[model samples]
Target: MNPASPLDNVRIVLSHTSHPGNIGATARAMKTMGLSRLYLVNPKSFPDSEADARASNARDILESACVCTSLEEAMGDTFLAAALTARSRDLSHPTRNARQAAGELIRYAHHHPVALLFGRESAGLTSAEISHCQLTVQIPANSAYSSLNLAAAVQIMAYELRMVLEEGVVADEPDPQLPEPASLQEIEGLHHHLEQVMVQSGFLDPTQPKRLMRRMRRLFARTRLEKEEVNILRGLLTAVNPHKPT
Candidate 1:
């Protein structure tokens, strides 16, 4: 283990992880790959027996894992944060497979502390959460069933890094995105209005909306709407409303 190698310096961040076992397993996976840094950002549950038990031989990692109150705090000093999202997101960040993500990690690790952030098992990374990351890793999978466990996502990325680092093929170029990144508050407001419009248009039924929202999320994600585009859509939406604000 190069005490100072990229893999050693890279931190595996679990954001709002719900399961203790996943936390333990994530530590074990990180350990198995010769990684030691683990960060927990507002875990739903930690310091539990199951998690400690699952960590088993890797308890040191659990003990050493930094507990952070927020993702921004956990990402402190990290110039490169790559989040694992099951599908595309509205924010346009460079999307890569596990290999490419690992390569980027290693490339940036020398100058800065890099983080690989994974979200909750059910929701994965939220749009607001994804905004913090500089890039995203999309594991190629069947479109029909693409869900993967949070820990599993971490393991795959870790394994890829271990392999590529051993072969010494780590390098990266710049990641491109919209010139002006939209703010989180802006997106939240837009989504709220969007939901109302969908409901008013009878496109999204409140009763069984999970799937519909999921699909809509994917649609907006694919669009990677820019700030100007978001404004245009919101403006058009407002213009059509019969009762405009005075």
Candidate 2:
């Protein structure tokens, strides 16, 4: 029997997708790559005939897709989120080529939830949306006309992930003594706790907040903090502000 695929823990998140056909085609693309988890965030049209028709034999993926009201909801438990975009932004997160990002995600998904986040068809993810992602992945395309169909982009990413699994390019199993990496929710909680302490301690001013917190978020995003590490950090934050609980 074949070994289980790490793709099982990697979810495809379509954010505010405008076209139902693309949504269906994305599901088909993911299914072809042996990826079944699909999360839709505020899709314009779903459960529509066009999507069902496009999905074809992969209709099961569409039927089981998790629909959420927001990206945060879709990424609730995901430990890593890689945003797909071609545009450059003023404030960007750590970036990697599609292949590199896919390999990293495959390794992480071996034992935890990770996500590939794609934006709408007309325009890619907003800077605010991109900020939430820990990494950005850009596909190399013709510079003159770099635009790709939403489904095509999904296919490319899914293909890379499938290749990683088929080629057995994954991180070795952990030693089991170390705590598991913290989940996205846990990390977000840590951020919240830290921010509260920072504000209370006068380290960060809420009124004219510079990119301080954003930079901190980026710094922590790349840390891949373990559960124990997060606990230790939270403990430090509590120590800093003993009068007020974080």
RMSD (Cα, Å) for all candidates, in order, is: 7.3, 2.2
In Å, residue 73's CA in model 2 sits off its true spot by: 1.8
lDDT of candidate 2 over 94-118, digit per residue (tens): 8898899999898788778899999
> Which 10-residue window in model 2 sums to the lowest lDDT?
169-178
Q: lDDT: which candidate is best?
A: 2
Q: Candidate 2: where are CA atoms >4 Å away? A: 1-3, 171-179, 242-246
Model 2 TM-score, all chains together: 0.91
Count clashes in each candidate, considering only residues at least 3 apart in sequence or on different chains. 0, 0
Query: How large an RMSD does model 1 have?
Result: 7.3
How do all models score by TM-score? 0.69, 0.91
Show where candidate 1 strays beyond 4 Å.
171-246
Score residue 181 of candidate 1 by CA lDDT: 34
